[model samples]
Structure formats: C-alpha cells, structure tokens
Target: MATDGHGGLIQPRKVPNPVRESQSHRELHRELLFSHSRGILPRHRAELPRVLESRRLRQLREELQGPPSDLEQQLRKCHQRLEEAAAGPDPGPRPEFLLVRDSLRKMKLAEPGAWQT
Candidate 1:
C-alpha cells in the first residue's frame, strides 16, 4: 500500500533487471554448447518431442544454455552484471539495458526464443 506522495497509490514498477541476457548470435551447432555452457541437451540423444514435452527439463536446459552468442566468452557473461565502464554508480546501467529486458519478458523462459527470431 505504497503511495505516490500525493494520496495516489504507486503502481508496480515494470523495469527489467540489469542482468540483461547475452545479445550475440552464433549460428553454431548445439553440439558445441554441450550440457553446460549454452544449455542442456537431450539425454542419450532423446528426440526433440521428448525434450519439448518435459516442461521442467526444458526450463532447466534453457537456464544452463545461458545466452545466444557466437563466442564462448559472451555466453559466460550472459546472466552476469552489465559492464558499463563509465556508468559508475551514478546512473547504474544504460538505457538500452531496459529495452533488452523488456524483450525478454515477452519471450518464453524455457523456449529457444533468443536467436530464433
């Protein structure tokens, strides 16, 4: 029940977190990502349908996959804090971070939506 200082109620904030998902694209085969860096793969080469049907597994895989990038270094930085050198503590992250976060909110958490489109 927070107020806006004028008797008006304050609405919930919708800003995206500073932990923006990686934003690089790598048209590489899933074999390279393995079950750690990029994300988890089908156990024993299980079919796509099996992986898709399992909602829990799908979510786990996506988390492990990190973010889409052609380079391993970028992937490693995916979920990490944004590196804005001059940003300092005054302004924190840049404005672009918010845009990146908004796009993520519209995406399916466990699905391959980052590089798909």
Candidate 2:
C-alpha cells in the first residue's frame, strides 16, 4: 500500500522479479528507465520527425514539378492536329481522333484536385 499525493490510500508499486531478468528483459528495463528520465525514447529520439519531414518535403517537391511534360506534349499535338485538319481538305474522323480525345481526358484526370473544381 502507498499514500497518494493527497493522503489517500493507493496501491503499492509492483517491483519486477529480479529472478526472471534475461538479456532482453534487462535491455527493456534499461530502455524504460532511460525513457522515464529523458523526454523521448533513445532509438526514436530523432527518427520520427526526420522521417515525417522528409516525406512531407518529397510530396511538396512533386507538387512543385506541376503536371507532367508528356501531358503538355500531347496537348500540343492535339492543337497541331486541329490546325492541320482545318487547313487540309476535310477528311472525316481519323482513328487517331479517339486517341487525342483520350489524351485530353487523361490530362484532365491527372490535374491536381485543387484545379479540378
């Protein structure tokens, strides 16, 4: 039995059985003791924040690159195709017409959500 901070009755702290101590148990106990004295666990003292920051930075970098260049190229090709079609004798819908439409749809889908509204 133990006295609480306000003089109330409280359960006694349990003592670990020294007889059951093994290598792993000793290591665990050491880690627990160290963590209790310090603010953070030793193994993870700097790892968590660094990993999270790196992940955030990677996402930001990818966002900075904007849309992929291939999408822009496809759009340019579509424009060129339109110009050529307008200049030449009207040839009704080529098979490549479907490809241009698909590329435009893909480009729309690949745009960032913020731009989509």
Candidate 3:
C-alpha cells in the first residue's frame, strides 16, 4: 500500500503490465485516428497544433538564400488556426481538413506575391 499525499494508505499503484500497456497504447492510437477521421476530434483537441508548430519551426530553421518573407504571416496563421481550434468544440471527423488548411496557408505564405492584401 502506498501512502496518499495526505498521509493516507493509498492502494499500491499497479505497475503497468508490459503486454497490456503496449496493447492499450495501440488501441488508443487507433481510437485517436478513428476519431480524427470521423471529425469527432477537434483540431485543437488533436495533434494538429503541435504538428503545425513543428513544421513551421523547421521551415524557419532552414537556410533562406533569398529574403526573409512570409514566415511571420505563416506563423501568425498557424497561431490563428490554433486559437480557432481551441475556441471550438472537438471537430469530430475531418480533422485532416484543418491540417490541410494550415499546410495550404503556409505554402501560400511561402510563395512570392501570395501574401497580398
């Protein structure tokens, strides 16, 4: 028995059985993907924000022989998408659409004359 934070005799935490843990993780991944495909998982609820951030960061790190353009706008759009996702309920199914939109926005920003008013 493990003592609780309050000094109570809390039940011993069961160590995760390796096989069970693996199976459970796989199940969870599958469920996440399913929910995303079904549009049940909102963009903010899913991993889109993290993925977009990572991509944007990577792009920023790449050497640009030309001018420093579109990066700020792209980042801003990513931030907006994240905010929108956070503001809305889980968009079950079609989470990919959010990702696609983010990608397109980034690409557009990358293109010359694409970031016009």
Most TM-score-accurate candidate: 2
Q: Give one digit per residue, the lDDT tens place, for model 3 in 1-105.
A: 565576785567878778756978889888999988887764556587778878988787765544446997798899999999999997677689889999998
Q: lDDT for every model?
A: 0.63, 0.81, 0.79
Query: Per-residue lDDT for 32 in model 3?
Result: 90
What is the TM-score of each predicted model, taking all chains together? 0.15, 0.22, 0.21
Error of 1 at 27 (Å): 32
RMSD of 1: 30.3
Off by over 4 Å in 3: 1-68, 93-117
* Candidates arranged by TM-score, highest first: 2, 3, 1
> What would the per-residue lDDT of candidate 2 be over residues 8-60, giving only the tens digit for each residue?
85668989887557788888888898887886755576887878888999999
Candidate 1, TM-score vs. the true structure? Answer: 0.15
- Model 1: lDDT of residue 4: 66
lDDT of 1 at 60: 85
